[model samples]
Target: MKYLMPFLGLVALLACRGKNVEGKNMGKEIVEIKKENTSQGVDTLSQEPRLKTFKGLADTTFVRLADFSDGFAFDLRYATENNFLKAKVYDCAECYTRVKTAKALIAANKDFLDKGVKIKFYDCYRPNSVQYKMWEIVPNPQYVANPDKGSIHNKGGAVDITLVDMQGNELDMGTDFDYFGKRAYHDNTDLPEEILANRKLLKETMESHGFWSIRTEWWHYNLSAASNDKVANFKWECND
Candidate 1:
């Protein structure tokens, strides 16, 4: 049966109420979206056994890394041989929210890309261990929460990204990747108009495809309903 899920944008939550035989609106039901909760422990499509190696990030036909022109691209750090950003140093690829969504995002905004707004990814799939490290680095209640708590990145449910120019030059997003400061938050009003506008564009576009952004970081977006289960509960390892 086709299921109807409430769409939660980048920051707002949706309340879903059901009607019983009485035809009355049921009470408010808050659907908790967990990054790593899957049903039947299967992949979204082929159900090709889920990857759980937590090794360095590798792109497969399934884990397509696309660009503005729908051209496939590798993680910059990986292409440059940056091991830390890789699986061991940071293994979090298997939980990816399917490449199809990225294509949809591009198709939805063909004009933006043609105008030179390319999607630049800071981080994609991440290992749960790496997430622990990030939590250790921040540790603030308002920021990282708890290392043990983990994050959507650990489940491949989230992506840290920004915009780039047609020439592949990164735009000024006020701060670099993993910049721990007040400026990263979406509501930070101290930034310049250009920066804010750039962020807004990124946010609006991603949210249009059912992705949600973290409040502290404009670059981070969590994929809601990316899987059949409302969470990234499935465990993934490298196919290699």
Candidate 2:
């Protein structure tokens, strides 16, 4: 009986060994198949190529005045009348330049705010969509290119502005924003001296802060370091 028990144990051990060997052989076969498939460039997990997408397009880091001040009053009616579409209507809140430049301008020129030389921003922090609209309204010889192509305003690098006297009067720009006419030109001698001087001061002050004026538009100032290569679809928040 003792000898029989020993024999049975040996048989059970041998059967387990054989099953393990078979399992190892099956695993080896699977590994080899995978290797062969990979070598043949037959990727089992088929994946599509990565699509091209605009990066950081919706960066609303710029500002809107309502977020900072309850006294923020934007001329939505005037803006619409002028054909200037506001993507985020109030003011550029996240825009450091929007806030800093105004503050700096005020700091340097104390009378800027008190004297009724109030800064009226025609457009700021425009999204790519509004740019496209501008292009649709007028393309080509128009320097305001398609946002799909590239726009200075869309990059948060450009601003369209005007100034008012102490009585809250709007300056007499030769032509309004989006005026597809020769009157909008910087060298338009047809405009009055006061108008020209107003334009020049705006240009000089902005240029001092590293901004450049567009020859076609007296009120437009392009900020330095704005990426011309990248297009931003970013929308500025009116309040935040």
Candidate 3:
């Protein structure tokens, strides 16, 4: 009987020890699960979208306009063969400009959005090489800028743009882009009322944003502050 009691007590001890071991293992698993949840939370925070800021960037530094704002639309005619050059000078279609120019453009676009329209870009900063290529094709000072002299476009100060409705349809400015005739002139006021009104909206809005229009082309605007900037040859990468 004594032996039987001792054996039973030993069995009870072993059972209690097994329970303790299982409890320790369960505690370890719970800690591991908590750690995994924390890691997942960090990953979720990191994946959240954060807008790029122009806080510390220099005014002359070139940046992709789309990276800073997705509100603007891009056509980038020079990237296609539809331009006056009839050749694809840019490897890809991208809108890059000086930081100051981008800031002004974003502000101007916000104002445009309030009017049920937005600015649509036909072209942005042009590399010096692309300017030379354009000069080679046309070689006309009235149409294309002399590459050696470098236009506002090569200095990241000029943008060819037009207004588009919220539906993405371009507002008529009397003539299509790259038109070199008197019909495309801003001073030619003998057009339809709607076209004149559209041009007025574009010109006033852009001028308020520190941009000035050329007398010859209604679609061209140059940032007044960027006139002294050196011409750039910065190029963008294309996706495979």
Candidate 4:
């Protein structure tokens, strides 16, 4: 009888050990499930859209800005008869700039995004031919740069831009784009605080990214490094 009791105790001990092992296996399974879920979440985040890099591109090469980053908003005025000329001069609406200029712009836009806004382009990389068309319309050096001299825009180094919220609504800069009066001037600070603040953000961010603004137009910015680039007349084809 004593022997039987010892054997029964051994069986009980074995049963307890088996149950402990089963509990450990269940815990391992739960851990594995959690790890798999976490991995899937990371994969989903990695699948988000990524901006293209400028590798293998030359500084002088012109590229469509939209191809590199999807974050910017565009309102190409010359393509839609909304500018001071009241004419659609471009074949279509597309923002193209030199690789170096585009890189600076993308960097500036990232800074703007951190402030809960982004750069919305009014114009970019005007062809030399388009400059002549603008000169013919205005025929005044005060309003339009002569095609013979070539504006910074013709060199793909200049852009006209404003800040806009994530919802695509433009921030007030005191004057509409292409406004030819003193209200559009950067030094004309006789304006509302909000407008000044908006312009300040745009100017500071652009300047930090190697762009300089002119006194006459708060919306215009020229990349300092691209001033020497030869004027380009290469036109982008419109996709029919």
lDDT of 3 at 15: 100
RMSD of each: 24.2, 18.3, 6.4, 8.4
Q: For model 2, how does the per-residue alpha-carbon lDDT over 127-155 read when each residue is reduced to its tens digit?
A: 67766766665566455675666776666
lDDT of 2 at 50: 45
- lDDT of the structure predicted as candidate 2: 0.60
TM-score order of candidates, best first?
A: 3, 4, 2, 1
lDDT of 1 at 14: 24
Candidate ordering by lDDT (highest first) = 4, 3, 2, 1
Residue pairs in candidate 3 whose N, alpha carbon or C atoms collide under 3 angstroms: none
Error of 3 at 132 (Å): 1.0
Off by over 4 Å in 1: 1-62, 66-88, 91-96, 99-111, 133-148, 227-240
Per-prediction TM-score: 0.54, 0.56, 0.80, 0.80
Using TM-score as the measure, name the better of candidate 1 and candidate 2: 2
Best by TM-score: 3
TM-score of candidate 2 on Cα atoms, chains taken together? 0.56
Using lDDT, give the best candidate's number.
4
- Each model's lDDT comes to 0.55, 0.60, 0.93, 0.93
Error of 2 at 111 (Å): 6.5
lDDT for each residue of candidate 4 in 1-240, tens digit (9 for 90 to 100): 989999999999999999999999999998888778777774522467667789999999999999899989999999998999999999999999999999999898888888899999999999999999999889999989999999999999999999999999999999899999999999998999999999999998899999999999999999999999999998998998
Q: Please give the range of 10 consecutive residues that has the lowest summed lDDT in model 4.
A: 42-51
